[model samples]
Each structure stands twice: as structure tokens, then as C-alpha cells.
Target: MAEIVPDVGFLKNGKLKTALLQHKALSKSGLSERLFGLMFSGLVYPQIWEDPDVDMAGMELREGHSIVTIGSGGCNMLAYLSCQPASIDVVDLNPHHIALNRLKLAAFSALPNHSDVVRLLASENTRTNTKAYDNFIAPKLDAATRAYWDKRTLSGRRRISVFDRNIYRTGLLGRFIAAGHLLARLHGVDLTEMANARSLREQRQFFESHIAPLFDKPLIRWLTSRKSSLFGLGIPPQQYDELASLAAEGSIAPVLRQRLEKLACHFPLRDNYFAWQAFVRRYARPHEGQLPTYLKPEHYRQIRNNVSRVKVHHATFTELLSEKAAGTVDRYVLLDAQDWMNDRQLNDLWAEITRTAAPGARVIFRTAAEKSIIEDRLSPAIRGQWTYLAGRSQELNLQDRSAIYGGFHIYTRTA
Candidate 1:
């Protein structure tokens, strides 16, 4: 594999610092924010959490629609290709995410077949995956992306070797889930038992018998009281506050319990891959359970054919939007990022969204709180340009298989 000195300066990247540091250096919130920045600097979401099916439906995606979205783990962008979007401009502050998105595009274009791509990306088989990467995917990657995968870790393993193991088991989210399993084990609870639930009743029974009791433990309650404890879930200080606020007594334990319950009981384990990832630490096999929309077999050909339409950039969404001509983009997927923004950041983002949105453009996002984050934060003039589809947002939020978010929002550019 091609090699280079590993680039580890992403934690200090100015854009990330500016976005995450909203408090004083010595303050409690500031320290939590810094910790989150450090954790988020590395690969965070091994698999993006937002449900692409809900996203596509909310955007009302149409053939040839131009889209601009944050590239977290790159799943939704690939899924959008199945809808035949004309172009997708993906931006992220994390360089790792930029590289991951580019790598996925290359894998789709260069891998020999759907099965090879699936094994390399969605499954664990180190030798075959590493061989496939060296022979096929590596040559297709851009210089920057190839370098990212080829760089050696502290253990001296090439970054691409993650695919040889389980790539989903290596990132911050993966570590978080693993930690959750460990915690449950310590409490004599087998969280993975939720996956064995053959029906909704069994799922609820397992949750009540096993998962629900963990939150009531004194240790679990104390640990969750700290805002920094949730950085593993990619929840920064601001969003943590929002989640805590949802609980009647300001305890995040109840909030977490409710979310986990929705994840476990709202959908059948056989159909909800989000539940599978939560309880099983990986997606189900092809014959075992449903997969993400992008990973489903029927969409493979369309994703491959449309892979060339994606362009990945390492930048903030506002920065990327400022460069676009007015009335250019037709769809926007914000992915709960607004939860991390303050009033100024929210206004600035809406300004760009309003300025660049084409007629009939649709914007969809999620919130950590039960209501829209932009309710009164956005300046009137900019906010007036869009209509909030409250009914549609609620309907879609209910259908979101990844049931972690408190709310899903949709805003359409006013004619």
C-alpha cells in the first residue's frame, strides 16, 4: 500500500475549533466542547445515523435535482444517488469524512461487483477486503483519499485495514457502542438480547427486563449527569443540554431510555438496521435483516451508475453554500447540525440557505429537542423565505427508523 506520514492535525483545524468552542477555555462547557472536538476530530460516525429513507421522502427528491448536504459517514449521499439526483455537493469540516466520502464513491465505481463492494464496506473480512482495496479500490481513489487510507496508525496498521476487520467497529461511534455493551455486561444485562426479539412484544419484554433497568442504576445515572459523558454519541455540550432538558427532572437517563425504547420497540428487529447496529454492533447479513437504502441490492446498479455525480469537500456547510450562485441548489439535508449552532451561526446558515435555494427547494434537518431549533433564532427576513412543513415533519419523524432524534424538520423555499 502507498504510505505517508499520518496527518493528525484535524483536531486543531480552525473551522472545527470555531464551530465547537463557544465558551471560555476554562469553563465547564468549554472543556466538554474541547473533549468533544478531540473525539470528533478522528473518524466519528462509522455509519451515519440519519435514516436516508426519511431524508429522501422529506426532500421529495426528484430526478435531476441538485443537492448539497453534509457528508458525515457518506451513506445518505450514496443513497441519494439511487434517486437520480443531477449532482451532489458534499461538505464536511472533518477531513476523515471527506476522505471517506471520496473513498465510497471510488469503491462503487471501481469494485468488481456488488458483493465485493458490500464485503469491503458493510462486512468484516480483513484479508479479502485488503486485497480488494489494493487491487481495485486503491487505484480508483484520488491521491488525497488513497493517502488517508494508506497512512499507518500508532499500531502500524494501515487505515484501510479497518475494512479487513469491521470498519464499523473502529470509529468513535463504534467505540461508544462497544462501551455501552460493556456497561450492560457489568450490570448483568446482555443488550444484544434485543436482537433475538422475534416480535415487538419480545423486544419490549427484553427492554424492560434488561435495558430499562440499567438507566435506573445509580452508577448509570451519575455517569449520565455529566455533559461530557455523551460526547461518544457525537453530542456536543449544546446538544447535550437540549437532550437533558427533555427529561422531566433534567436527568438524561430518562431521555436516553425513551430514545432507546423507540429504537427497540417501534420497529421489528428484522427490518430496522439501526436497531441491529445498536444491539448487535453491526448490520445484519443479507438474508438476516434489511440494510440501509444505499446498501440494498436493488439500488447497487443505480449507485454505481450515479457515483460520478458526487463531489466531496472539506469545509463547513455555510462556507460551501457561500460559493454557490443564488437559486442553485434544490435540496439540503442538514442532519441535526443545527443543534450545535448558536443564534448567530443559525442566522448565518439560514441566510445562505435562503440566498442559494432554488424555487421549490426543500431543506430537511433534525433537532435534539422536540421542536425546531430555528423557531425564533433565524432573522425574520431570511426565515420568511421558507415555509415550515410542520405536519410533514411530524409524519416523517415517526417513520424515521433510526429513532434517536427528537424531531425532524422540513422547510421549503417559498415561491
Candidate 2:
């Protein structure tokens, strides 16, 4: 079977590629690094885990805003359309992700109504999605993207069959989530029971009682301590190192414990589709209306109306930024891509971003480590162009329902 992700060469020649080769070699051995590299090379996050609502709050988009964001699963880009931005340029190195973003826009444009759009994306019967894609979306897509989804997978099924089969359940994160459920079962915990908990108090009780104890087990500690075991969670070797550095003890288990606690207990489950996905592995019952902001019924009209505001590219953030004229971009969402970059790459990206940023333009990103990577790695001249909104960033981090990233940063153009 052809792999869903063919390569992780988003940054072709650099320290990043060197690290990828080392990780790929490690993958040849049966541990997690190979899987992480393979997954990183493909569609990893079927549904992005970041909190778009928190991102929207921080962006404070005005009518004239033009934003640029990394298109992971294309969820947040769709969510931001509701803010009525003038235009949004969504870029990613993964062609599949660019296709996903394109598919979303086409669906919104072609579907008869909002409910049909919801049924196509959120419901289990992929026939709805497949038919929708064939009759509605396919004609609108560029030839390259259409061919991507039309290509058959290992099963002799067209890649679009993924949507028909519950796309959210397919991808590296999906398989990883399935593994987590399996792990929980071995420890006498039912993740679904935690998912269906009636209240936040019940949620907290379940985590403390049923889930928390599992982290203390020898097996989990052993698994999580290895950098390879976390590939499903989309942690590259560098990210794993950053996460490991957060603790003086260097045990990822404790960090995992804390993040899981937040995922299970921090927010109202009725409202947090992220938690439902973590525990139940699907969005909240479609009837109950728990979904990502982009999938919510209330925002459907605005999103569909504004879906045209987005333009997608299979390109890196720096490459995309370098093409724009100075002082043109107003908002940026980098989504942990910085963690993958070395100092030279960081400096190059920030240089373009600095040149392209409009007055008061804002950039937000997540980090695998708790510290701001730009502070130490970026040249002082490039870094000085932006002011770190440290207090607000930390506050947003606390409220992030995804509860996985170590830090969420917000930086504003100072001049």
C-alpha cells in the first residue's frame, strides 16, 4: 500500500532535513521515530487540536484583516472565516492538507445548504461525503487536488473514501488516539465513560480516579519516556526534546499526565469537541451539536459565505511570506512550525514576517517547550521588531482546550 504521507521534506536542504534523516534512520529500527517521520510526512492531524476560539479571541480581527496561517486539517482557517476577514492565505508543506483546505472551501461553495455541509463532514455515512465530493466539490477543485483525492489507496478504494469512512478516525493522530484507548483499557479505564461524564466535577472525578492512576504504571512511563512513542501525537524528535527539557527530571509522563488532566477536566465537555475527540474519538454526538467552531451550525452561514476569502498553497510559511510585499499581512498563525526550525530557518522566517507585517500585525504560535524559542534563537534585530505579549499568551495557554502544547505565544509588530 502506498503511504498516506510520502515524505517529510517540507524543508528540503537544511538542519531540519538532517534531523529528519536521522529520525528516518531511527524509524528503520521498530521504535516510534520512524512512525513519527512517516506520519509527519503525511496527513497527521485529521482534526487540528488547537483551540480556534482562543485564537480568534487573541486575533481580534477587524473587517480589513488579511491573515496567513498554516493549514492543518483546515479547521481554524474555516473558523476564522466567520470573523469576516478580507482574505486569508492558508499555506502548508503537505499537499494533502492543502487538498483538505481546498475540499472544505469547495464543499461550502457547492453544498445546497448548511445542514448538508454538516452531514457531509460530521456524520458517519461517507456516501454523503463521497457523493458530495463527486457531484459538488470535485468540479471546483484544481486538477492537482482533485487527482489527489481521486487516487486509490491500498484497499482499491479512492482516497475520498476516507471521508466516507470517518476521516477523523484515519490519520496518524487518529491511529494514535485508538492506541491510547487501547492503553487505557489495559489499565481498567474506559475513555468513553470519561467522555460521557455528566459534568465538570464528574469529569475531574473520573480523571483523578480512573485515568490518573494509569500514568503511574510502569508500562506507560516506559512508553512515554521514549521519544518514539509520541509520534502519533505528532511530536518530532526536536519537539520531544523541547518537551523533555521542561522538567528537571525529564520525564514526559508527568507532562502527559497534566495535559490529559486538562483535556479531561478543564472545560465543559458539552462545548469542547476537542475533549470528545480525545476520549470518544469523534466529535460530540452530532445531535447534541458539540463540534469544532468551524463545524458548528451557528457559524455555518458566515463561514460558507466567506469561504472564498481563503486561498491555499502547498508551501512553507517563510516561502509564502517572502512573496508578499512589505507591510501587507495583518495576522499570522504559525502553529508549532517554529519548533521544527533551526536558528537560520527561524531568522529567515521572521525576517520575511517582519518585513511583511502591517502595523499592529499579530502572530500566534504554539511551542513544544514552555519558553519562547524566538527569544534565544532569532537575531536581536529581527526579534526586536515584534513585542511578545507574554502575559496574554500565558493566559491563553491556560484556557486552551486542546491542552497539549507547552506554550501558546502571541507577538505583535511593535513599529
What tens-digit string does per-residue lDDT give for candidate 2 at 95-209? Answer: 6677777888888888888877777777775576788789888898777778888988789999888878688888878899999999999888888887657888999999999
| TM-score of decoy 2 | 0.92
* 236 Cα displacement, candidate 2 (Å): 0.5
Give the top-scoring candidate (TM-score): 1
Among all windows of ten consecutive residues in candidate 1, which has the lowest summed lDDT? 1-10
- Cα error, residue 286 of model 2, in Å, equals 4.4
Superposed on all Cα atoms, model 1 deviates from the true structure by an RMSD in Å of 2.3
In Å, residue 243's CA in model 2 sits off its true spot by: 0.8
Which structure among the candidates has the greatest lDDT? 1
**Clash pairs, model 1 backbone:** 126-164
Residues 116-184 of candidate 1: C-alpha lDDT, one tens digit per residue: 888888886657888888999898887878998998989999998989888887788899999999999
Model 2: ten consecutive residues of lowest lDDT:
1-10
Task: Give the true-structure RMSD of model 2.
Answer: 3.6
